[model samples]
Target chain A: MGPITGEQIAEKLSLTRATLRPDLAILTMSGLLEARPRVGYFHSGKFPHQIVAKKIQSLLVADIKSVPIVVSEKCSVYDAVVTMFIEDVGTLFVVKEGGLLEGVISRKDLLKTTLGGQDIQKLPVGVVMTRMPNVLFTHTEESVWSAAWKLITHEVDALPVVRKVAQPDGSDGYEVVGRLSKTNITRLFVELGEGN
Target chain B: MGPITGEQIAEKLSLTRATLRPDLAILTMSGLLEARPRVGYFHSGKFPHQIVAKKIQSLLVADIKSVPIVVSEKCSVYDAVVTMFIEDVGTLFVVKEGGLLEGVISRKDLLKTTLGGQDIQKLPVGVVMTRMPNVLFTHTEESVWSAAWKLITHEVDALPVVRKVAQPDGSDGYEVVGRLSKTNITRLFVELGEGN
Candidate 1:
């Protein structure tokens, strides 16, 4: 398709060029349209989702993951609650000896446990943690697409990125490397929008 | 690119046709790949986010918006809290005479108000409601992309889908039509994933 001039768009909409400038700026900045010095403007051939998907593809887990918020599996539910509020995160990665990924605990998990009226100070977080195999994870080489999918599908707010390492006993175990959350994705989205 | 046969893919991966069949079937059903009767299989040219974005584009606010969980502007904070919990929603639309959208009240707003230790049963929700020109909204004709963007950029969970209507006394006011929330977006994502 031929590049469209702002004049043409304004005319087609029966609007003044002044009235249309802001909307055009928004569309171009969002990557729905593109402008060239002399070539006028054209559709970017990228929809919002396409741009986001491309961004997700370009990002490696290592580039986007942050230090994981972790809790010892044996920590008390009360301690977990305090740690959660202190850390200001919605979920916590529960680990066993040597930072091995064991399970995950969410705000709801802690809330439900606390509401049970058990001795929160003595009750282990391990009892309420979402165990292995059920906990979703991403590896260093994986794209954020997979991580985001796990988030949307599992209806969870975060995932622990892990790496498979050989244990002292020669068994394979996952070591928590970092964490990925919706906040990271939103930050990336905002960055993408700036460049669009 | 030319279509590739299942046999070729299986051979390249060092797997039997039987072992690879189900995985191929899953990918095909997910809209990541396409199969032609005589031409074999080809990449579908749609990524995960593209599928989601397309779904968003095709959806109108009117189709997905839910009945607005609303409260009268004159309603007390205690009543608003009760209405929110009863409706099982995190936000409430505060309306004036004749259902004109006057303001918005969120759970956080109610919680903060209650924590002040004031008389909740007497203090009107309008006292704390986010008023006009501040409450973000969408119209029936708007796409889900615009709605979702408002959710992300404004960092709010729900939006009141509204329509501009002429007031009896001569100005214009917004009539709350329905509500759009993050849960709606996630539900749409799950639906897209099912056949993608």
Candidate 2:
């Protein structure tokens, strides 16, 4: 089929556009379809099963990333630990004043700090974090395959999903918007398996 | 529809029976179909997208769990750490002489032990592991949904997939045969999304 509008899809499904948006987004992210700003949606001509060999490369980050569990860089390690447990997430993104991506921390980092017998409440997570250069991140437009690969290769649980924005200093920096983890992928898998 | 055999499926797909066994196994694991000992395979009539809500209740742990990455309980924490890194897993199963799981060790545990400045070579992983009463496990016949739920609820990356066997001591215990992780679920999800 040629490009079809969301309105057309909604009509065909007999559901409101709002009700179908999420599913549409998932389909778009998985690379089954392409969406254009004003044109409409078009089939990618790639069958669903074809996604396996390509590693779901057509599914973009924007469709699957979840809101990030973040902590300010200046937050104490103790608070970071608490946040992690409270959020029930393995990794936390460290962000700056304007919510720009700063660093990343994992349970191992916190456990190491705790084992040091250092005052967790006094130590800033910034000091204990895997700093920016070492932090592996992904952009919203990038493929989920690459994002998942980073998780596997880097051996980390989560990735900060960000978008590049102009910095005040005339440099380019990433602004953290969401997070992606194995859980998100698994959840998506279950969704697809359920055929929903 | 009704009872079908692997040979039938293989013929329909134009694939040899040998080449189709693995796919059949995956389908059984995902609850798309069922296998009867001498009766052959039968359609479950459950669609793939429906798997999300039921969490793949029809898919058994035996169908999807992968080989476990294990370390001896008597092994040094340092060696355990090395094994974990080498295996590229976040958790390690500390098994006994006969390969019975004794405890579970995570990256956090090893890091904590390391940061304590304790001699990694002398300390056994058993001392740092989450022992018997606290370890979360799954039975071979149990559903993958429950396994996935345990992973999410416990906020752990992997689960020891086991089978109950009579011990020499006249008691019953679990024998680790495989492991189920977020990766496994995600991979399954990708496979399903690909319609493979």
Candidate maximizing TM-score: 2
Give the lDDT of residue A48 in candidate 2.
30
Best by DockQ: 2
Off by over 4 Å in 2: A1-48, A51-64, A75-79, A111-124, A140-146, B1-67, B71-87, B108-129, B139-146, B187-196
Tens-digit per-residue lDDT, A122-187, candidate 2: 999999999987789998998877677777667677899988889889997888899999998766
Measured by C-alpha RMSD in angstroms, how accurate is candidate 2?
9.6
| Candidate 1 segments whose C-alpha is farther than 4 A from its true place | A1-56, B1-196
Docking class of 2: incorrect
lDDT minimum window of 10 residues, candidate 1 chain A: A187-196
* Model no. 1, DockQ: 0.04
| Candidate 1 structure quality by residue, lDDT tens digits, B1-196 | 4587988776655669998686567556545568998778876666554443444466677777889988888899888877875776768998887788999987657655654557887999988999998899999999766677777788776899998999888998999989987656655443333333
